[model samples]
Target chain A: MKIAVDAAGGDFQPENPVKGAIQAVNENAHISVCLVGPEAPVRKELEGLDYPEDRLTVHDAPEIIGMDESPAQAVKTKTRSSIVVGLGMHQKGMVNGFVSAGNTGALMAASAFILGRLDGIIRPTIATFFPTIKGQGLMIDAGANLEVKPEMLFQFGIMGKIFASDIMGIETPRVGLLNVGEEKEKGSETLKKAHQLLEALPSFVGNIEGRDILAGNADVFVCDGITGNILLKFGESIPEALQTLLFAAMKKNQIDGEQKKLVGGLLKEAFAPFDYQAVGGVPFLGVNGISMVGHGGSSPEAIKNMIVNAARMAEIDINKKIITSIA
Target chain B: MKIAVDAAGGDFQPENPVKGAIQAVNENAHISVCLVGPEAPVRKELEGLDYPEDRLTVHDAPEIIGMDESPAQAVKTKTRSSIVVGLGMHQKGMVNGFVSAGNTGALMAASAFILGRLDGIIRPTIATFFPTIKGQGLMIDAGANLEVKPEMLFQFGIMGKIFASDIMGIETPRVGLLNVGEEKEKGSETLKKAHQLLEALPSFVGNIEGRDILAGNADVFVCDGITGNILLKFGESIPEALQTLLFAAMKKNQIDGEQKKLVGGLLKEAFAPFDYQAVGGVPFLGVNGISMVGHGGSSPEAIKNMIVNAARMAEIDINKKIITSIA
Candidate 1:
């Protein structure tokens, strides 16, 4: 199997991607990587690293799209960009999957433009994976297409369910529609109709409230891109704020001895040692080929995990299943 | 000043409401109480409560709305319920303000129906307090109206700013439109238009990210009812979940003994012990009269706090100020 990595993507680009590709090559001897980026920096990171020469190769690109760059403009203008080159490789079957930590908009645009959307899909969605109270759940369309219809949400649910089963190892994951209230009649008119349609599905768990997401009430949480974006961002920001609050609280205590210890101890226990960035990329499902988009601040470990996740998706032929089911 | 209390509202109902009203009376000798609910149960709870005979009175209402009842349906059927009676008293000038912990939907409906909407206010909104990183802020239409327009959101910002300044004593509270990202152009079409419109406002702080609410980026976070409801519930549920998670972790010795104590201490420090239900219930700002809707989960302390808040609103003539400003 072949996988393409956008070496020029993300904040800690070239270096992290180079290290990640080396790690993926070491773990999966059967897989080959086509690293896309400006050759100089990519080679600089790989200088001291030893790897299986035959399994890793680099595809040089002249320019890179920035995080703040417009997706459409970048995809249109920077045709030689790493994202475009990687997507082009996937389209030509030179690589079965593509991974990037670049501009989310640019990644989405390039994937949709080059790989194209699956047959039954309206617009491809960005599905985010998180460790919930019950375990791991996938939230589809974390922030891809803003204006989504009922049909689009249905496709998201279908894709999310398939992704959960194929990647997360859930045999028949329970799917829940993220809503304000549990009542079927509650939420917007769009949601009410979507709920009715989702209820007919076998593994549908009805409506789950925002509070229930942490409790991990559903294996797959579905929503339109707009609401889904806010929900995903909201979930991601909580641990971040909690950490800041804890540090400030700890700093506020000066004269305390046992009291200080108690405060310090509680702060440590409250936070689980989860390297959120390590869970880096989210899979942009519903595309013709597998595409993983990582965070801009992704570290080497996170990039490595993202590559592993991409390989898992490729091993399970997730793209084929999504196209078959959602199509 | 006269404040009406619904003795039959809240989870604790008659007992808490009676105790709260008695406390309010004891604390503020000048305020009069018109206890509205089932005569027998309310009187039973207030049997031994000693206060000025002239200041204490009871109005009989025999119906109750269950917490689980649908808001619209409850308002339509439970005509003689405590919430309705309390709101009616406020409308009739028999009381300066009304408070209930019965049902949010019913409270909003009854307040809109009895007291009516303020000028230029197309729909009544449930404005409640939010605990910001700096202090507490107010969010309007917390869950009053689900699908909202840009105009409604703009009104919420205007009213929320005035509310924070007049009630909470924040000078020119930084008003922010709660959105998915900080980029001025980063949300739905409605949000885009709202941003454009808000840019014209003198006090608008542009767009605020989900993390900013706790980061203390803005004094007032404004959004539609659905988002506001989700955000509020998210805030309430997260801290509770984290607390539960810590306890479970501590039980298995997943954390050390000292760490357990520290986590517990941090949890306490992180959460404020504010009785939101009794913080004078959710005030239906943009209404003609001063009416507050308390959560059914309210305890006596919550009811007492709500009564105090209501008295402050009445004493300052909040309704008149809001009406004049909006007009």
Candidate 2:
């Protein structure tokens, strides 16, 4: 399977993507990567790196899309941008899938516009993986759609189920609507209606609350993008907040220098499990074909894993499964 | 100020509330306490306690309200319950305010039904105190309204400002509408419209994301009840989750038992500052009278704090300020 990588994407640009693409081809035997960017610049990043010469190729495209640009405006204006060109290659069936650590809005916009959504799909969404005690769980509409209709929320559950089952290997993946309370009557009119719609699925576990997310109560948690995004951001801020609070405690207790270091080391070790980049790329579910996006600050290893995961999705034909399931 | 305490409220019941009432009267000079519950049980709790003869008294209330009972049904059926009696006394001007650590929903229902909402108030909401690096930031509609209109959100901001200014002692409290992004155009149509509505306030700081919550970005974080409730529960779950994750890390790192205890002690010390109960009680703002609710698992100290806070609210005539400001 040939997967295109947006070389001009992410905060680090062509160097990280180039080094990562080389790592992907080196690590995975059967997959070839197409680096999409300006020819000379991308090739310059490829210099002195030991890569499979035949498998690693550069697809020249001159323009670049920024992280902060407006999604629709940028996609329309930056036609020759790496994101557009890479997705263009995948749209024409020249590549099986595309991956990027670019502007999430731009990636989603360009993917939906270029490759289009699958049949029976209302709107494609970004489903992010959240680490849980029981393993990884998927939260749909992480930041894609700010507001969603009941029908759309129900569809997100269906898509989440398929993605979790086929991609994450959870058998009979359970989907839960995120609500204020577990009772069916709780939350806004939209959430209550969405709860009813989600009940049609046998895997629906009624409604789950915020605390249930960390407990791994459900394999998939579906909600509007606003809730998911806020929670995601809030969860990210916990470690720093804890560290600050902990330091204040240490100072108050007069633990001094040596004991502080030991305690700090232990705290760091405990928080080590929350490495978001290790998950590689999170696929934009309900799209016509495989497309994924990593965190903007993702490292080279994360990019390599994204390439491998994209290839696996192509091999597994997860998109076809989603289409069949939804139909 | 004479503030009634529901002696039958909270998990600890007559013992904690009765003891707490004595503590409140003892701690605050000019304030008196009236314990509301079954006269026999409440008197038994106060038998050995030393309290000012003229400052502390008990009002007979035979019925009891359970935490899990339906709010409307409980309020309707349990007429002689401490919650009902205490609120009834407040409504009749026998007491300046009522405080409870019982079912939050039932308290809100009874408070709204008996004491009524302040005139011109769109809806009465519970604004809970959140501890931040700078100080406590109030989040309105914590769980009072499941769904809120743009008008209600704007009103929450106003009520929150008055409470923060009059009670919390902030000179010019800032209010921020919680959204997925800080941009004016970001989030759902409801949020965007709410953003426009909030612009009328000189203290409105555009929109704040979830990350801004702990950093005390605004004195009051305004949102629908669902968002606030979810975030509150999520925050409460962090310490335990961190402990679980930390223990796992400790086991993996092969720390000895002595070292484990030391690390655990330091961790606890760090989390020591997150005493939600210390804030006493959160007032149900926009109500016609002073009514506050503490955590269900409140200790005697928490109960005492609640009573003191209720008395302070009565003294400050917070309700009058809310009415004046909203008008």
For candidate 1, the docking band is medium
lDDT of 2 by residue, B1-327 (tens): 999999998898988898888888898878899999999999988887798979999999999999888999999999999999999999999999999999999999999999998999989999888766667889887888977788899989998998888788898898999898899999888888999999999989989998888777889999889888888777776777888888887787787688788768877776654567666789898888999999988888889888887888888888787777777
* DockQ-derived CAPRI band for the predicted complex in model 2: medium
Candidate 2: residue pairs that collide:
none
In model 1 chain B, the worst 10-residue window by lDDT is: B272-281
Off by over 4 Å in 1: A247-270, B248-262, B273-280
Residues A110-142 of candidate 2 have per-residue lDDT tens digits of 999998989989999999887666778998989
Question: In model 2 chain B, where is the ten-residue run with the lowest total lDDT?
Answer: B270-279
lDDT for position A96 in model 1: 80
On a 0 to 100 scale, what is the lDDT of residue A95 in model 1? 86
Candidate 2 chain A: 10-residue stretch with minimal lDDT: A269-278
CA error at residue B299 for candidate 2, angstroms: 0.7
TM-score of chain B of 2: 0.96
